[model samples]
Target: MKKYKLILFSTLSLLITPVYANDNAEQLFNERCAACHSINDNSHITLRERLQEKAPTLYYAGNKFNRAWLQTWLAAPSKIRPGGYSFFNNVNVTDEGDVIDESKITTHIAVNSTLAALLTDYLMAQTPKSDLIALEKVTLGKINRSLGSKDFNKFKGCGSCHQDEEGYGGVSGPQLYESIQRLQPEFIASYTRNPEAWDPKTLMPNRHLNDNSIKKLLNYLNVISQ
Candidate 1:
């Protein structure tokens, strides 16, 4: 399986032409990723649903992804859904009631390091206009008693249908004790804006929060960074 994976990655690298060979990551991003993501848009939609029927934007890539992780994810594209990505927007379903189409789900084979590095660098360069909030700079002391409770019950409403820091919320979406460390912020933001953007058939709802909620959530995730 390891050899098979290597062969697959090699085949993909070969497919990336010499014209694109040694192509600057930014240039490659412009040519390949710009169509689906915005560099600075901060609109925050719902968990499963996207503002538009597209995937999320990338305004905060710099703040979100681990360069190493980014490289690994992009070298190969995987099916993130059981029946592919879709939303329950039209269904008026609750997050608790929502269901993922597992039949359409699949994972991508890992990629070679060089291609991954190029993609990671390209993605990491994207930054939002906001000043460095350094939300990640917050100390472990801050996440103690009161603040931790606030994270569970306050404006975040994370407890409503998902688990995180306190593990007190509903079990709807993925856990987030280290979500910031796990997901690309840009990817998360973009998905927040438009769940259906990349996969038109996802089961998540489209959140329609104003800009403030978006920033707050972003900050919340940064604070929760592992």
Candidate 2:
């Protein structure tokens, strides 16, 4: 009778303990996705790095992707690329554009549906620690695309490696058409300031701009986001 009671208690502990102590979802995320996605800061490598392809960072996954959509995406990985998620601009890690290999991504372990649901629930709960401050109230008007092009090419030297319509840059960086929606300013600013903060293997060079240029570029990015 004591052995039967011990067995029952052990079974109950196995069932109930996981609910309290399990963090497998995060472990799974770190193991599978951390190679490509960043959560906190800029990477040490250039944006052209293979590990730095065009996938949106998980740092803002809580903000950008809706819960239901993320879950469905996990269950059945589909082609979300129109042209490609990551494109080469000019710093030149590869030819054309770099593509993030998301073809064999696993949203959940091959466990039962119940465990899959639990993983999804945990993943959706991860929100960025920083608040995203929208610049809509500050800009008050649209940024001129022509001026933006000029600034990107001539003033900031952004076009030296990144591609823009001005026909003056390299194809080493990712295209920046709708990047404002994809990247968080916090990560962008930090990377702009220091690429080593994120990944140690980045190839992008650090800029020597003063504070004013940084502010201008940041504001430019904010303006384009609109």
Candidate 3:
């Protein structure tokens, strides 16, 4: 009878452990991350609210980010967007062009390894767009680096906004050299295909890229990230 009781207790403990961890992670996220980032779905948020946001929404983090990268990034945060989350806030109108005031940008809050792991686990479970992510079918095809670079920089004009190499492109958009490491391939494809579908108030234009173009771009992103 004592043996059976112990077995039942062990089974219950195993089940309850995950719940407690989840609760703790949620509490930690609320305390440390909620001020800058949002875990709630903000698709219906007003344009003014979206423009005023301090950081990117994490409600679809599970669908968007690579788990390992997210974990590492949380522990040692870096600037993904050189111009800051709200680009308008960091840009200065100059005689040459609109220049990003790098001094105005702030780095993300870094957490210790334990806190990062807990936060990453919690954030990775918040996948509201699992269906959308599922719809994207990505195939890894080999693309020549030179041709890909030409297409990315000259033909497609992506270099005008995104950096395929560190400190080598415009600061208005998030750096793309580490995109494959940071973001899921499907999320990249989906966002590139239609930026407004993901963020209604996004500054990214709808280029209406075909599936072939997206695949080529994905291949290019993969090569550059590596």
Alpha carbon deviation, residue 61, candidate 1 (Å): 0.7
lDDT of 2 by residue, 1-226 (tens): 9999999999977754454226577765555456666555443446456454646556545544545655655665543322233433312344754433344332332344455465567755665433432311222234567776677778778766555532335544544444454454554555566654443555567776665566566666666656
> How many residue pairs clash in each candidate at the backbone level?
35, 19, 0
**Best of the two (1, 3) by lDDT:** 3
Each prediction's TM-score against the native? 0.50, 0.46, 0.86
Query: For model 3, how does the per-residue alpha-carbon lDDT over 1-226 read when each residue is reduced to its tens digit?
Result: 9999999999977754443354688877776678989898788988899888988999889999999999999999888987888888899878986688878888777887887888888989988888888889998666999999999889989888888999788778899999998999999999999898788878788889999999999999998888
**How does model 2 score by TM-score?**
0.46
What C-alpha lDDT values do all the predictions have? Answer: 0.54, 0.53, 0.87
| lDDT score for candidate 2 against the true structure | 0.53
Best by lDDT: 3
Candidate 3 TM-score versus the reference: 0.86
* lDDT-superior candidate, 2 or 3: 3
Better of 1 and 3 by TM-score: 3
Q: Residue 112, candidate 1: how far off, in angstroms?
A: 2.9
Deviation in Å, model 2, residue 155 alpha carbon:
2.4
Best by TM-score: 3
